[model samples]
Target: MDDMSENAKSEQYQEKTGRESNPIGVAAVILLLCICFLIDARVGFGALIGAAAGFFAWSLLKDNGTRKEENADDRVAFLDTTVLQHNFPLPQNMPIPYAVLDIRGHILMYNEKFAKEFPNMELILPVVEQLKKAGIGKHAVVVVEEKHYDAMLNQCEVVEENGAVGNVLNMTLVDISKQYELEERLDRNETVIGMLFLDNYEDVMDSLAEDRQPLLSAIVDRKLTQFAADANGVMRKLQMDRYILLLSKGDLETLKEKKFDIMNTIREINVGEHIPVTMSMGVGIGGGSLEDAMQSAKAALDLALGRGGDQVLIKEGEKYLFYGAKAGEVGRNGRIRARVKADALWELMGASSSIMVMGHRNGDLDSLGSSMGICAIARAMGKKCRIVMNEVSTGIKCISEQMAQDEYYQTAFMKEKDALKEMDDKTLVIVVDTHRTSMVEGPSVLEAAKKIVVFDHHRKSAQDFIEQAVLLYHEPYASSTSELITEMIQHIGKRIKLRSIEADALLAGITVDTKNFAVKTGAITFESAGFLRRNGADSIRVRMLFQNDIDSYKAKATAVRDAELYLGSMALSVCPANRENSTLTAAQAADDLMNVTGVKASFVCCKVDDVVYVSARSFGDVNVQRIMEKLGGGGHFTVSGAQLKDCSAEEAKERVRSAIDEYLKEETT
Candidate 1:
């Protein structure tokens, strides 16, 4: 029995050491086991005896002092591993998932908790590799079996006793599923407020037969209510033409992904009315209070209206994101708004001690002509005013030359710096054609003036939108800012008649912006033009302002000659850098490409210095305004341009193509 116990112990030691015995050692062990079994007459005792003999033989021949050496080495290794794990900030034995890996992502050791917590190696390996690339001491959130974990990684160098060094990474994971659940719940419950305005509400109501008004109202109500119910929200009618709605942020996200089909759905409403009903909605979220959110929605609604009132806008403090298509030139809320703005502008001019008017950078005819019209208004009022003219662009070169021939214009224009010096808090700054401070002839002048007035016909740019306007008259429906100014001059103050030359400038502004009244012209556009003509605007003189010089005409022709059709519909070309009239050349080239057999849109790029200027033109078949907006520019749907800094002509062409492709993809989807 004692020998049997010894044999069992020896067999266990041999298994732990993992050594093979020699052939003689095996034979001796068998003989010894047989003798022991015969003497004891016990089979169990004999088996133990053989195993013990084999272990003794293996220890003596295979490794001298093999039992103590192997056991000592194992103890040292075990102690070292335990000490290494203990030195970590997070203990491996803690109630957490822990793993150690070499820099090559080879698993060195892992706790039982890690294997149990992350049973799927498929999920861990990929995340670990990403985290490794993210560098050491990085934290990332990953999911395993639908449970979220906040994983942390650390690295160190491990030097073995043989003087070999290797990089080691330590990964620790903590369960964050509960925290994520709470966050998701909060996010799903956040409030989203939307303000809806019925675009062309009066036009629709007035056009409908008296008996159909009630039916139309009911249909609109049903559609809005259904939309609210689908989103698990509340809808309330604020006025006959305005509404407010409440929804959760999560639901708003879904609507954004779908591009707010409700706008299109509303546009489909036709109940005996010539004009289809359309809704302009503004959404606000993440505002701390209901009133704040409502305010944001109101601001967004203003942006939607300013951008032509057929889209949805989400106000983000200084920036905004828009969705839905632009409305046609309906002029739904035109006469009344224009009259009110004119009255307010007259009041502001009357109150201010001095006034200064300016146009956009490199002022085109619409910009410069509108500024001159405002200057005329100020001059008639006998208020001190000057037009800020930085440089003579090709679009306004003819008008400038005409004005230079007259002595009254010699002191009429001032440099931006001189204008800034004379500006004051009470100086009313009137900005025409463009509302962006960055696009203005002088941003400092706009920023310094206390009372600012904006008169623009272009869509409000999303970047650098001028704020704190004492009086603003923005009409996207107008063909040009010149059109708006011309209409205001007729009824605003006293009977202040404009000179024929000044009328020529204003008419030329409208002529260029409307492309000789060939695009974006409305009933009101013609009325404004007729008013300009009656005021002595010479058509022969205005046409001369658009005639390109010989070199400019040649450059434009070269651009048109090199036109390449993109996507079978868009014509793209590059005009070589011409220091003189580059913008004019690019624009004329884009306009000429519109004459192509199947072209729907055209883009012309001209690189000058470090800036690549792109002029875009479309034929209402494509929304070139939106495409230009993607490239950080904004304009009318049929005409727009963008500038790319430090970009090659080829790069600008690629960007325009990409923008067009993306727009087409979105429309198709």
Candidate 2:
């Protein structure tokens, strides 16, 4: 039994070391030794002894070799076990889904849970590359099977008998769908604040009889209450013309979907006549706190009111979403604000060492005339002033050329590049006719000046507003920027007299923008024109400033001839390509097309240099500013223009048609 046990242990050791003894060879050698012993007793005995010694030595060397081989095999087995344990520490049947993928995102190994969760799943190569670039050992959110998960990826170096075979990522996924849903729910339920103001409420009330005023007010209040109720919000009347509203994000969404129909509903209510009453709504959303939201609402309300009212503006962080700008601005009968703005302007100008007056690019009659008016004001105040003039169009070329020869006007006008050099820290830059920095003739001068003032009659745009203005006089209700400047001149008092030609220039601006006072002539507009006339502004000279050369007249005729009606009301005309002073020609063409009966609006497209210029005009019914704004331009409701870079005239005409179509579609919807 002892010998059998020893033989079993010896066999087991040999098998483990891969060095099993050769039993047949050993038996043959012993038999041969026995035969030698029988043949010669003495000689055989000696030979047997020699053979036994050699066999013993061979066995010892073989045992040493087997032991060395066994050590090497054990080391290899241990390394394999260590690597397996490091890469896959979890059991195959663990509940948590886990996968092992190579650096390239190829699946190498996966547990049963992972296989069940993502059957035949393959890792996205881009995602894996991103993970590898992120250097692994980090957690990232991933989605699988329409479920959110938090995946923790760990980088691993796989080892084998040779060396490091390759690198792999071990990904463990934790389901986070419930958490994600909860966050979304919280976000949707966040509170939002809003303010609604009845635009020109006092003016409308004053226009109506006392008995009718109460009826208009009551109707407006009731409609507002209904609007708030529809959105499941709370509304409180803040004043005779304003209300405060509180709602949730979801409620705001509902209100947006309805397009805030209260604006149109209020307009429909007639207090004995077409009162043209409208409301401006300002909403604040995604604010961090109630106070923040309230502040945002107030800012939005100011913006809406500044932009001619009759619109809905939603403030979300740094961005804004606008709706309902269908109606033209209600002309204001009061000049109280104009006087106030003039006083503010006087103080700002007084504080400056010098004043730089600038207008929009390609200075037109309105831009140039408005700049001249402001410069006149600065000269009256006994302050050094410079008018930054870059490009002059033919519409204002006669006046500009005449002014250039005059000593006083020569000193007044300066090139944009010189204007920048002349500006200093105490210089006040008054941007006239345009409030946008991008449209200013000398943007560098605007940037260099420490004090800034803006006087514009165009509607305010959220994207292109003067951020650094000390005083901004924007009256969209006024006919023209020149009209606003004229009002300021009158308010500045009679001592600040405008020269005969200066008055003519200001009148020319008003004439161009108002289409010779045939459109958008409000009470204030007439008052400003009257003031200019009293100061010796000649109507004939202003009319001559609007006359075009023979080529320009022919270009205008061509544009008018090519006019095609769109949506049955909008006339779209594409001028002949590459004409001199095409912008001026296109604008004249658009004005001429509007003369055609039944045309609500006219858009003329022309090409100059590499830009496509579009001039838009409307007749009280269509809001051309809103349409032009969509194409990165802005102006008054009845008159607006846009410049398209790197676009052909034909392409611009098509875009104009699309814009008109979109406007019509939205109006109907």
Q: Could you tell me every candidate's TM-score relative to the true structure?
A: 0.83, 0.80
Taken over the whole model, the C-alpha lDDT of each candidate is 0.83, 0.82
Question: Residue 320 lDDT in model 1?
Answer: 75
Candidate 2 lDDT tens digits, 140-207: 77766578877777977665554435556787888899999999888888888899888878878878
Tens digit of per-residue lDDT, candidate 1, span 369-413? 887788778778787678888887777877888788876676788
Worst lDDT run of 10 residues, candidate 1, spans: 83-92
- Report the number of the highest-TM-score candidate: 1
- Model 2 segments more than 4 A misplaced: 1-90, 93-95, 101-109, 115-146, 151-155, 161-164, 167-169, 563-571, 596-600, 620-622, 654-669
lDDT of 1: 0.83
What TM-score does model 2 achieve against the real structure? 0.80
Candidate 1 lDDT at 437 equals: 76
Error of 2 at 13 (Å): 24
